[model samples]
Target: MADPTLPRADEAPGTIAAQVNKGQQFTSFDVNAFEIPNQREEVWRFTPFRRLRGLHDGTAVRTADPSIVVDGVTDGVTVETVGRDDQRLAEGGAPFDRVAAQAFSSFTDATVITVAKETELAEPVFVKVDGPGAGEVGFGHIQIRLEAFARAVIVLDQQGSGTYAENVQFVVGDHAHLTVVNVHDWADDAVHVAAHHIGVGRDAIVRHFAVSLGG
Candidate 1:
């Protein structure tokens, strides 16, 4: 039998960021809406497709509980409550292809976390995503930004009951330093998909580490 799930032979090389960005505009690309003709594709080979498919058959987006803890000295970093106007929360962009945009629409209401200007935070800012239902699926989105000369550490904890998908985006300013640690601790039956977009300005340094446990 012929392999029906293979990516194109002549796919472009580069990170999704490099391929999607045209000058200053950011293009939207949903990996789930597209097809890969072969498993040799850089991003698709390591992914568990069968598990991912099971997740797609799950549920829709819903309201989630958010827990944020900002510890230690925080003169440089200020946790602000944003009401849906942040650029990281903007919608409608050219997808990696047409199919993605048509399949998965952008979510509404993303928690915007910001590190203020000239603020050098000592400890880490923890953001935890939790849900209420069991054997239930949920969806959530988050956005983070750091101003010029600011420095901070951010830990994003993604956890759910049954199965879930979370969309996250980040922006770092010039001369800023940001260290992000993503910890995914979910139930064995949970299927979680996290999408991250990070933009590092000139002279900015952003380090990311992801740790996953269970599923």
Candidate 2:
């Protein structure tokens, strides 16, 4: 699905940056409620504006964290949390389009997922991010990475009890092997927006699996 957090016609780029700066960013609203502009807009044509909103209103929901557990790990998999400015994130000139990145980055100081550089591994790493609703707003960021020849599976499971919005991002390295599974078990009223940007280095492969259980 096209991320709901993407920009709308009325929202200016500078306005968006200001909102991010003030920490008053928008959540994963139902995208269908908005209108799709003509070809003048760069990213609108390829998007599914109708299905983007789905069949629900997500503004008033609360936040809930999804549950996750690392059931298995092999020798090739090593999991570590690195600084947000680690080498991988810096390698890409700009991982995300300026506005969207600033929206989530402004509110979040630390990234939840970080894999160290040159870390060799043989197993899978499971990461779960879930939030329960409180009839308010909830925003956060998650980042992931793999060094050269690093092999592993990263699983992301997201759920919400009330209604909430969330932002996420992931990265992969050259010759690195990564498999990611994302499960969305959100309440009907919840709005979830997760952004994943992966860089496949030479001879590196990353696989993704996403399942929407509820909502």
Candidate 3:
């Protein structure tokens, strides 16, 4: 189906940003608030619906728990698994789309990583997520926070097989520097969709690098 509200001829490509602003906005965990995508919306237009394995339409269900591991822990860092109601979950930002909202709504636990102020890590933190298996669909959420003047580097490594949707949020405090690298190396049949949101504070430096080797 074609989009009913197409951009006018006079509208420049830059107008896309305004479309993003005008799109659905939700701050709470309610999947019912967002409409199911029909491949007409900006976000779903480019996505491969068949590859999603019913994640967008809500037919997918979690079959097995994926393995999540965090390595290279430092003294100044704290990591914890918190509930969705935790106040820290809202520190980053709200869900920006249906998949993000679904992820937040479906995930049983949320991972929070915090770097204390004025702390510098000698080694990079590594987060690895391994898919449950084929024919299983999973949802996950992760939040990373860097306190004022903290400096750190984080690497997210994804691999294995399954249909997965995830939301990752990064909040950088003033004068902090955070660099994130995401590496995707999944099985050929794996389907993974992830959205990343970053909130940078005054004078903060944030860098994101993505490397995809397989799907």
Candidate 4:
């Protein structure tokens, strides 16, 4: 099924015609450039503002140090943690919302995973992000790239307690085949919000599956 948050191409002509600013896109993040969501905008209308724990606004602080583990490494795959200022960070899509902007501004480091061209992995790459319990709030960013003709599968597992917001980006090169699975299993009191952006190159094949078992 298509994600409800994304616009569908199969909508009726009238529905498409009813859209305002047909060619306009959301504003890119600039920290001071975006306004905090007030639950009135289209993006926030369906979100529970109170449950965000100030993630939508500037009141949230990064009080917890989340643990990240990468397992099942295979040949031709590379994983590294880098400062947010890394040039590769800009290769992904820009932030289109305040929360995304906030996450970018708040996070000091980012994780990057790269699959070399023409390389096919026999085992799935597993990335686990575990948050510390309590009322802490945290922010994070992750980027995954598959070079041309690369074939791989990745699984992201998120768990534990906290108010966390994150932005993830996937870049698929020409003729590359990439599969991603995201599993969210959080503590009952945990509050998490995330945005995922994907850029598919010509003739590339990309598949994404998401499962939310808890929150």
Candidate 5:
């Protein structure tokens, strides 16, 4: 089945997907909703557009699909790959940036991690997300959902090479506790643009850590 989030027939297959703007006024699942960023824009003034490897301008086409796998499944935790139409997607929030929206609207599938309500895992779940290759480009998304009163630790190890853009959502349920670590260790020439959207629920606690091993 075609994922609802993917571009429609009239829409270019992988380009111009996003409705959000520079001012952050509105958001949508459509790609044409966003304007391509240039060196002149305030939000983009400091970004090296050339270094993006065409992800921002829609010139980069996905050369490969990302490979996501977990070290092991712990009790009370379920990891599944779901289509973009999955209701659980974007639970934390909608795409707030053009790149983020593009990633959301372009990805065919998403990795969803769910911690059952009130269940605590004995060990952390390690997820490894690998990109296509050094010269390739790809778009992807991942989501972590914690049910009410649950507690868990997650380690996201992102590696491999390529020009990659992605969005990650963390939805913490009421009274749940979550701690996450994200490590970026791509090849020296690789390019990556990513957004991490976190939504903390009532009485929920979340701790996040990021490590960039490659400059």
Candidate 6:
């Protein structure tokens, strides 16, 4: 996909910002760039504000990092724990809302998984995220990238008890195939919110399934 931050050919420089598909005007990594919703906004109207645990207003903060365990790695796969200053952090996209931006701003580290160009994995990759504890707050970010012509299946299983907000991204290169299955199975008292961004290159194919069986 073309970088949304770059000016169009017909426009002058410094004239671009990322935009959401339906309602958002612009995307930013800054949490304050977005306003706090009061249940009047379309997006937040259906959301449960009382269970947010301060993710919208920033009162709830990350107390401990989530324990991330990656399994089923193949030869062409690369997994890394990177700092916030990593050069590849936000180039693909930015947060569109306050909770997502707060997750972007508050996370102590990021999990990045990349598949090499033209490599196809026969086995699926499993990523399990264990939250801190009940009543605690956690912020997280994760990015999965598939280079040109690569094919892979990824399963994200989120577990534990807590209030968690996260921003997850997927970048698929041209002609690649990516299938993602996200399971949101948390404790009964846990509250979880997440924003996902999928950027597909020319001719890329992506299949995403989100199942909320718990929480």
- Name the candidate that leads on lDDT: 6
lDDT of each: 0.59, 0.50, 0.81, 0.82, 0.82, 0.86
Off by over 4 Å in 5: 1-25
In candidate 3, the residue pairs with backbone N, CA or C atoms under 3 Å apart (3 or more residues apart, or in different chains) clash, namely none
Q: What TM-score does candidate 2 get on C-alpha atoms? A: 0.56
Task: Write the residue-wise lDDT of candidate 2 on 1-215 in tens digits.
Answer: 53344556664332221235434443322243233333355754564434433212322322333333344555544344444445543333232332234324333333444455565545556665555453434544456657666666677767765433334555667777778888887777655555565657888887888899885
Candidate 4 Cα outliers beyond 4 Å, as residue runs? 1-20
**Per-residue alpha-carbon lDDT of candidate 1 for residues 1-215, written as tens digits (9 for 90 to 100):** 43322323443221133322334332344444344424576645676666653433322444343334434435655455454445445531233422223222434445767788888887788887764346565545567888898898898876656555655667888999999998988767666666676778889998999999967
The most accurate candidate by TM-score is 6
Off by more than 4 A, model 1: 1-26, 29-42, 53-86, 91-106
- The residue-level lDDT of candidate 3 at 180 comes to 98
| Residue 140 lDDT in candidate 2 | 48
Show pairs that collide, candidate 1: 5-37, 6-36, 6-37, 6-38, 7-36, 7-37, 7-38, 76-119, 76-120
Across 118-212, the per-residue lDDT of candidate 4 in tens digits comes to: 99999899989887566788888889999999999999999999888888989999999999999999989888888898989989999999999
Order of candidate numbers by lDDT, starting with the best: 6, 5, 4, 3, 1, 2
Q: Please give each candidate's TM-score.
A: 0.67, 0.56, 0.85, 0.87, 0.85, 0.89
Q: Write the per-residue lDDT of candidate 6 for residues 33-92, one digit (tens) a residue.
A: 678977899767888887788988989978877889899997999999999888776665
Q: What tens-digit string does per-residue lDDT give for candidate 3 at 1-215?
A: 53434434544221221233446343434565567887787757887787788777778877765778899998999999988788877767766567777777788788889999999998999999998788788888889999999999999999999888888999999999999999999999899888798999999999999999998
Collision count for each candidate, in order: 9, 23, 0, 0, 4, 0
- Specify the poorest-scoring 10-residue window by lDDT in model 6: 11-20
Query: What is the Å distance of residue 184 in model 1 from its true position?
Result: 1.5
- What is the TM-score of candidate 3? 0.85
